[model samples]
Target: MKGLVCKVCGYVALDGNKEICPICYAKNVFEEREDAYKMPDFKAPSGETEKKHIPDFTVVEKCGLIPGTGCVDVHVKIGEVLHPALSEHHIQEITFYIDNKFISNVMLTSSINPAAVIHLKGGTKGKVQVIETCNLHGKWFNEIEIK
Candidate 1:
């Protein structure tokens, strides 16, 4: 009946300090506290530069991502804009097949758009195989390679 009281978790305290009471520990009162939450200094403490980009090895171009299967969710950039004749939506199935064995097909790029970026199955983080392709007249060209 003296200090502030927790409305959400129903935690009552006579004195409100920097530390939170045990009853409302699960609510993480410190992070949501108006008085406690202060704007931290944006500058790094010493020599902290930009964080390195950790690639998802599992969903890269090198590793082929199977459809309908759970794989690493990643974004793949395949092929360049080669055909001005084909507008935006024209890519159907720009894939390559040899010997009827299906050596390698289109993993990302499609005719609807210039590039085909899809989420892999693994959904973890690793290198995946992506084939770059382009649509010319009617034939699809697979050129770029990534992993």
Candidate 2:
């Protein structure tokens, strides 16, 4: 899909316009990418190549870390088969969204695993979207509904 991508951190702006990159905090470094991301065919069986790039989500209705808050915990893991975390090729970052609105971005390095958990405010209800960028594989996307 066409979008504005951050040259430094690979964050994509689906609306095609952003003065600064939300992930990298880079100014005026956005470049238009004709194929910014690839959405896996969830309806069909995934191949080995697809399994290593798609983002996987695990949602908890109630928050575990902070109990009695009614908050939700959205866990995102990059790929069904864990992607490599070497210095040469690793997951650069993972961006979160709720109901088509940007939420947060988690930057990763070679030492850390390609996973993240975002705690949502109480009573949060909407479709949760996740995009993960791999240094060698470009970007991959996935989404889930929280009702």
Candidate 3:
């Protein structure tokens, strides 16, 4: 589903129809929500530049983790296109949330690639949300269900 995202607060509209931001209450400050799952080419065939700061959380290991076994490693990276970690424009941070609870946050700069493999405890079976913020662009989020 696509909707307008608030530029100030990174709040995604409940539906694409909303013209006002629910969180920041800002008007006329919404941009179309880009689907991070489907990555656009770094340079489109039409000669347009595509942004690739969208975050995608992928379960590297099997999601149905056995309790008391070990930690589950989740690989966080750009969906398909690699994001340029340049000094002028780059991703600032990546935050992890499990079942709506904060888990970990990784601070990044332009020198390093905006990718990380984070390990989470294997006991809880729920949703894993990954939110990444770009210095130029706002925040982008994606999730995966872990069993």
Candidate 4:
């Protein structure tokens, strides 16, 4: 089976029955990632190193609570420190998933910022996952519980 990774802490699971990440202690944040091995092997960082390599996604703006109307704007920063977006090494794509289903994807370029602003329809209300792949670092994932 593919390995699992913690979207919050960048913790990787090399074993089976991966339910929760030991480092971050996040349950629903773990997702089965097939390309996780290509990512650099590392442990969760402490307070000062939080922005070292982990992607930090923040909801810059969101839709109203009325449910199903306008669009939801989500901004994803590649990492707390912001990953490099160069021609040699850069993020390839940022994908958005709603309720484990594909919603939209943005193909990134080295010229633009590694961060992405994705617009999702205002109907989904379950789990929102943002997955990105780096040319040199492989794949990373972040999830948000929408209720």
Clashes of each: 29, 0, 0, 0
Better of 2 and 3 by lDDT: 2
Off by over 4 Å in 4: 1-43, 46-53, 60-70
Candidate 4 local lDDT, 48-137, one digit each (tens) = 323433456666334564455656667787777778878998877776766655566677889988877766666546677766767776
Clashing pairs in 3: none
**Per-model TM values vs. the true structure:** 0.25, 0.87, 0.60, 0.61
- Mind sharing the TM-score for model 1? 0.25
TM-score, model 4 to reference: 0.61
User: How good is model 3 by TM-score?
Assistant: 0.60
For model 2, the local distance difference test gives: 0.85
- lDDT for 105 in candidate 1 is 36
Off by over 4 Å in 2: 15-17, 26-29
Once superposed on the true structure, which residue ranges of model 3 sit more than 4 Å away at CA?
1-51, 62-68
Q: Which one wins on TM-score?
A: 2
Give the CA lDDT, 0 to 100, for residue 84 in model 2: 89
lDDT: the better of candidates 1 and 2: 2
Rank by TM-score (best first)? 2, 4, 3, 1
